[model samples]
Target: MGEKLKLYGFNNLTKALSFNIYDVCYAKTAREQKDYIDYIDEQYNAERLTGILTTLTDMIGATVLNIARQDYEPQGASVTLLIAEDSMLPRSQTQLAHLDKSHVTVHTYPEYHPETCIATFRVDIDVATCGEITPLSTLDYLIGSFDSDIITMDYRVRGFTRDVNGKKLFLDHPVTSIQDYINPEILRRYDAVDINVYAASLFHTRMMIKEPDLQNYLFKTDIYELPPLTRLEIMNNLRREMIEIFNGRNIY
Candidate 1:
């Protein structure tokens, strides 16, 4: 292991990771759409989201100071966790000041196109940390926690800290791209693009599944039950939806 760099006082550099994960399906009828929404709501309720975030906190070597979570009225949920970097710190020392600096949040959105019969579920997550704990270490776990068809991620390092010699350091670590932190096995499953500004310390990556099976996108419906032409149509619609989401624009 490389020798750790000693810093003067506390390391104040902030690293944040933001994710937008989309899952698409063909619901066919309004009833099926409603059922799909209900299914997603139950599968990713606030309580479940809290558990996920709590695990993430632990994975990053952070201590949870407080958690606020709620399930919405019709079909959605949100969870927020206040965290601190030093698990060994006394409760009195790990107060709102530290809690406010580090946090994890997740929110879910489920919706359906009434005309197109396409149902989509979206989950948004943000993990921000201060000091030595980098959120990049948890990318694999975060991606695995969701049914992600298309994913967009943004990572930025903000603020600065001082070294032992009193020189200011903008970034404590080296990061050329977010993909470098992701698993190669996961990278093989998707087509990914990166937009990074090295000078500004901002990196962005977008990923879409390379090949989607028809059976996987079908909800509550058997592939053998549908005619060949219907199956082809559903496949096209699903691909179109994924393309639109991956590109962030509608195709005409």
Candidate 2:
């Protein structure tokens, strides 16, 4: 795996280091050119490049080569996610939390736990919008099915066959488990408050795997298409897998 990846980011580099097969080293600067000594390990160090292609290849090895060194400032942003050229992905959890009731307007501050850490952290979800669906932006509406029999707090424009009565028909997709709806920022906020306690838990980092990928998820995993009971079971299994994976990483 180490030989195959040729991966360069620090995360991938560290992962590479975890294996003994690949070699690693720092590149030599022009200062070292006077006595030019080449590094022997082909696996890790780009510490020196003989020419343009070599340098370009080395940049590929390091993951980014086009940007000027002065232009980049990795620490400039704390956290960012990828975006596709054209994406119509479902409303993100952060966005959904702020949506006004058209049906699913469930409060981020859940009943009986309004003052808990989770609720307090949800304050970050309050956002400002022009009060309408704008291009390159969307007014978060409930996207899931609404069952008419079950009163849905989640509102959506999707399930409507006709607006004649001004009441929409829905196919119910009520949240299966309250725990499954855990928010990411809440964990981040918790970690911000205390290092030791946060460090002691693996829940936050691994929980990212459970997060919905929107379209990619719909196409690849098809998890949303699964039967309700199966989805519930799978979520539990995944949570267990996440916990165990983190636990295994801690083993000596």
User: TM-scores across all candidates?
Assistant: 0.93, 0.19
> Candidate 1 local accuracy as lDDT?
0.88
Backbone clashes in candidate 2 total 13
lDDT of each: 0.88, 0.20
Worst 10 residues of 2 by lDDT: 12-21
Give the per-residue lDDT of model 2 (tens digit) for 1-252: 012211111110000000001011111233222111221211111221112212222322222212211111211111111111111223433121112211101111111111210100010011111112211111111111110011111111121111223333221122222123334443332211111122221111111223422222121235556688865654444344333433435322
- Candidate 2's C-alpha runs over 4 A off are 1-16, 19-221, 249-252
Steric collisions counted per model: 0, 13
Collision count of model 1: 0
Among these predictions, the greatest lDDT belongs to: 1
Q: Which candidate is the best by TM-score?
A: 1
After best superposition, candidate 2 residue 147: deviation in angstroms?
35
| TM-score, predicted candidate 1 vs. hidden true structure | 0.93
Residue-level lDDT of model 1, residues 73-125, one tens digit each, is 89999999999876233334332122235999999999999777899999999
How far in Å is the alpha carbon of 161 misplaced in model 1?
1.0
